[model samples]
Structure formats: C-alpha cells, structure tokens
Target: MSEDDRTRAMRSPGDGRPLPQRPADGLRSGGAPAHRMPGGGPGAPTHQLPNAAPQGPPESGPKPGGSRVYGRERSGSSPIKPLRSRREPSESGPPSPRGPGRRISGRTVLKIVAGVLVVLLVTVVGLFFWVNSRLAGIDGVLADYEGRPADTPGTNWLLVGSDSRKGLTAAQRKKLATGQAAGQRTDSMMLLHIPEGSDKPTLVSLPRDSAVTIPGKGRDKLNSAYALGGPKLLVRTVESVTGVYVDHYMEIGFAGFVDIVDAVGGVEINVRQAVDDPKAGLKLKKGTQVLSGSQALGYVRTRKGGALPDFERTKRQRQFLSAVVKKAASPGVLINPFTAIPLASSATAAVEVDSGTGAFDMLSLGLAMGDSPVTTVVPFGGNEAVPSGGTAVKWDRMKALALFDALKNDKPVPKDVIDAG
Candidate 1:
C-alpha cells in the first residue's frame, strides 16, 4: 500500500482526520499518528497522551494510583509521549505492548523472593548452632543416637543417688560430729513425669526405706535398687511399681547437685518451721530463705518437722521444690545470664540422661514442663515404720501406683491428695 493509504488507516476513526508527524524520541508511535493534540501540531503545547498507569492497590495497603497519576510533573518543552500501557485509542487500534519504560521481564520480583528465602535459611541455621553450642557434655559422649524422639506414653527418670561422703571436708565432717562413717546412704531420690494435659502431673515420692520386690535381689527398699544393680535396676523397679514404661533416666550426686544450685545463685525455699538439723549443720529460722547448695541439701532432708511419722519432711520437699520452680521462672533468675547459663551447664554436667535423649531432647522436655503442675507423690497412710525397726518406713505401693495411673489417664488426683494434712 502507498504511504498515504497507510496514514489514512492510522487516522482516528472517531473523526475523519489526517495522521500526525512522528517525534524522533517518542516511546510509542503508531504508524503516522505520532503527534496529534488539542492545539494541534509541532510546537502547540497540548495533551498528547495520558500518563503511565501504576500498579493496583495492595491488599490492606494504601493505593499509589492517584499519587502516580495526578502528581506527575510535566516538562515544559518536552512533548508528552504516551507510555504504551496508558495510550488511549480513539477507535483506532490497540497499542503495541512493549515500551521502553514498561516492564518486560519478572527479573526484579524473582530476585526479591530469592533474597527472602536466603535470609530465612540463615536465621534457622544460626539458631540451631547457638542451641547446640550451649548444650554441654553432649558432643561425642552421645553418638549412634540423634534424630530419635522418645516415643512413650510417659517418661520415667531415675534421679541419681550420690555418696555424700565425698562432699564433706574434714571440717564439715567434724561439724556434723560423725567422725566419717564409711559412706552415708544416698540422700535424695525422685522420679518426674510429663503426662498429657494442661496441668496434669503424677509424682510418686519413694522413701529411702520403702521395701519392694527387687528383680533378682529379692525384697528390699526401693533405694537399694541404685546400690544393687545401678540405674537399670532402678528403672525396672519403678516400672514394676507404676506399670508405666520407663522411657529415660537421670542421676546426680550430692556435689553435683550443690554445684548446680550454687551456680544458679542458690534456690529460695519458704519454710514454716525453723530448721535446725544437727546432722546437716543447717540452722536457719523459718521464713523465705535462700540457701546455698550445702544448706539446700539439708533443708530437703530434714525430718525434724514432726516427732513420729516424718510426714513433715515429705511436705517440706514439695514446698521447697515449688518455691524453686517459682523463683527460677521469675525475671530475676531468667534475666541473670551469668547465673542462668552456669546453672544450666552445671546441672547438665551433673545429670546423666537416658541412653537415647540428647541436649535438644532434654530441652524440649524442660520446655514442656514449664507450664505444667509439679507435685510430689504422697503415700496413702502417711509414712509408717516397720513394727520392729523404725529406720524402715513402709510406703504404700498400691497408692503410689494409683497416683501414677491417674497421671497416665490425664485425670486429677483426689482433692484429698492435694489437701493432705
């Protein structure tokens, strides 16, 4: 076709109009109609084309359309040329898609998404390394066991029985006035449970003298399980007593326990009784008392609260533990980094975990227990001594098992259990 015919075809269909001349630098030039306007021609300042379109309003975000359109600054001498997206067609034809300023590829968007993913990956890896470094005694000591979760209805822990004989210096021994009996029996024993519920927990307090039918050694007190066959025997005895699978065990000695409590700046206990244990050399008047490791061990072991049954000792154990939990959770303890980390490290060092559980595994368990209610298991008929020997106290085995069962079923213990006098 001739150039004249081509120009005619490009003219606006709305009015029988001649096509305009093309500007050399304009971004959009449809055939011949490159420069037509209200005032018409080369130097006549007129609205040649509408401004470029902006992106739509974002979800929950402010719109930029009005700002982009109305506030656009117009150069006085420069002729307005349409950005292809905003070019108005006067019944002529559709504008060509590609203009110099219009986006042609999604390169910017792709780069942004990739950058975000990189940041997230780095954050995750940093957190993992920080937690790993904080865990002590877990590096090569535990191998052949990682990525394995403890899968059981409940968890059983065989807390350690330390020979306190080592903790006593010559002066300490003389102060207690025993002149070093070969080795006093283990002082503390406990089992912790993480049952299913908001505040549901079952703890069975075992007396050092509660006799039980041992696996191979016949009948003896439960504490004998540790001295006889070690942790394995303790696990088996607790299982036989409670009927729940023993998932894991941990043990700590007297020195270790004291070190840990001291590392955390000592634990606070609210005592209703003035504790004056001649054996432990703990002489503290009743009130809210913060005791060091040596003093803490004594307070928990004191049986001077009562004359006969020694039920007062058990009650004090629960009281002291509850106070420790509350104080440890308070900001004074949590924010004190020097005290907190050392305490955590010292406690972990003293604690010998179950064969399979690792540092992360143990951390998860502690986190789960943070909000759960913790209580010591109480015997049904308080504590009674053997008919002949007063040193041997008979623990209610059936009652202890019942308490554990209640925890497994996610049921609350009887109100009487909590309100025991």
Candidate 2:
C-alpha cells in the first residue's frame, strides 16, 4: 500500500483515533477516569448520599430554606465504583445522565441482534430470488432412468464423462479447441456411491473398458451406452450392471462444465504430476493450483495424462468435487445467498435428471454426501482381456450387488465391499 494509503488506514475516518477505537468511544477517554462520564462518578451521587439537610453561611446559597444548603464531605474516604447493576431504575432515583439505568439490557441487545438477522435473512432471500431470476435459458438436456440405492448401501451418483464432440459448428469447435467433431466413445465412467449407513462416501471408478452386459443392450463397452443412448441409457446400463439403483444423475458436457467452474470462481486442487496434454489443451506444473472451468474440464478429461491414465484425472475430479462441496456447505458461502445461486443454477441447469427430480431433493442429497468421507470403487481386481475390444474388469459381482442391496436397506456396506474392490 502507498504511504498515503497507510496513513489513511492509520487515521480514523473522522478523528485521528486508532482504527480499532470508535469515535464515540474516543470521546469518552479524555483525561477522565476510564469509567466516569459527564453523567457523574461512582455510586449514588453526593445528593443521594446521606447529608445534613442544611447549614448556615455564605458558602451555601439557600433562599427557600431558613438555613443554607451545603455540600457534605464524603464519609470515611470510601472509594466509589460506578453503579452497573441492571436492576437500577431511572425513575426510582433520578438516573445519572450516564444513567445507572439499564445500559441497553442484555435481553434488549439480543432482540436487536435478532432483528438484524431477520433483516439480513430477508435481504439474502431476496438476493437469491433476484439472481436466480437473472439466470435464463439454462435448461439443458434432461434424461432420466430408475436408480437403486447403492448395493454397497448409500446414495450413489453415476457420473458419465462423455467424449461427444459431434454436432458442433466450426466456431463452437474452435472455441473449446477440442478440434472437429470426432466421435469414438465416452472418455471415462465412474459409480459414485454413498453408503446407506456408511458414514464415509467411496468413489468406485469403473473402467470404461470394464466388461458388463447392459440390460437389453447385450454386452458392450460402458461408454457405448452413451453412444447408443445418452445419459439415460448410460445410467440405466450402470443400474443393470451393478444391481445398484442410481438416486440421481449429472451429465456435464465440455461447455457446461467450464461455465460451472467459472461461476463459483475456481477450485483448489492438488496435482501430483506435470500434466502435458496438447490434445486436451492442458499444460500445468505439478503442485497445488486453482483451476477454472476449462482447465478443470481438461483435468478430468485427459486420458493420457499420467502412467495410470484417466484414473488420475478421475481422482482429481473427485477431490475437486469435494472442495466444491466444502465451499458450498460453508455458512459464509451460503449466507451470501447470491453466490451459489448462479453456479448452482448454472450447474444443475445443465444436468439431466429423472422427470420428478428438483433442486431441494438434490441439495439435501448433496449435503448428506458432503458430510460423508468420499470413497472410490476402483477395484484392485484384475481385468480380463476382451476377445477384440478392451479388457473386461474382473469384479466380485455378488459382493458388489450385496453392497448395493445393503444400501437399499440402509445398512452398512460390508467392509469387504470396499476391501474386495
């Protein structure tokens, strides 16, 4: 800051008193004793205290009285302290100008505070509605399917990471820089389960190449479900595979994802590797960094990002999600009321859900999931080589099913559900 700025900061807005001290309070602290005011010093004033009614002499001026009224010397030199009791009444004894009367009674102060909170509450609620109104045309694609509670027991969101680059104009393609519409398959897929009775949430990352039979689609690539059908088909396919019903679904395309990130400012994420992806357009040094929408989308979309492939990216996405949850749940953020409305209105606006799904249900579920520790379902189990396609992952299907059934029953998912995975 400039010296002038520093000087301005040091000086009070009006008087030169220190910034921490109030102007009203500074006025009270002239050579006067800390507690005394023009009102009077200490206990009952001299008039209230015992004193001879009157006395003679020019020292006292008494016209009505036959004798003179003289000030009495304080008795025994007893030191006096200011009267601070709440019970003291102004009318009982004339209260001092610095009234021994109630100094804004605690109950009254509390009421005032409550009144302020009510005003703020109304203001924030107004802001929420106003900002939400500003957001228009956010409705995106809506696809719905039947989802069961996680068999591993708890709510689960089966997020599908799509690689749909098709149906884009040249300008739109140039903006995201993902190149022309190139269609192959979904980049990644994962089953996010919140155990019914399980306190911590676990993310079970299913390999897109994992072999599984979609309900009626026959056996195929998990990402193929999206190509065959969009999120509705994909979620249905997942529900069929795991026997776990999905309670909710969120599908964020490249553009929507970027907008959501930018709306909430950005998020802090830890990077263990130097991501050098010319294809996805991500280039970053290793360590912790705040990623905006486009960068975040890249972080979750990079398939050749590290030795572990997109698994690292999925992990990053999960952590980023957790941070987002933390920020949303904080009172400071929620109190702003306007902050989350835009991001949430934007984010959810893009999401596709079951026909009856609404914001409150989504928010309640999110809050529950946020409080739980997030766990992943990337099984240590090996994958079986597909005859021609990518390898099929070998999973303990029974155990996984049992876990989901347990979630349906709101019971703890077996520890083996996690251990076996």
Q: Could you give candidate 1's per-residue lDDT for residues 161-265 as a string of tens digits? A: 555556557876565443466643545565566665555444445666665666677766667767776666666666666555555565555566667777767
- Residue 344 shift from truth in candidate 1, angstroms: 2.5
Q: In model 1, where do residues sit more than 4 Å from their true spots? A: 1-152, 164-185, 329-332, 368-374, 380-391, 417-421
**Candidate 2 root-mean-square deviation in Å:** 20.6
Clashing pairs in 1: 160-251
lDDT of each: 0.57, 0.60
Q: Give me the candidate number with maximum TM-score.
A: 2
**Per-residue lDDT of 1-421 in model 2, one digit per residue for the tens?**
9996786565545665444322222222112212224565333122211342321122333233233113332333444545556755644555565744435669989999999999998976675555444332212223433453234345667665566554445775565567665654666666666654536665666767666776567777677777776666777777777666676665556666666677777777787788888777788789998987778777776775656564566566666666766666667666564676676666665554554445554565567546755455544356766544767666666776776565456555578776654
Clashes of 1: 1
Give the distance in Å from residue 30's predicted Cα in candidate 2 to where it truly belongs: 41
Cα error, candidate 1, residue 149 (Å): 19
Against the hidden true structure, what lDDT does model 2 obtain?
0.60
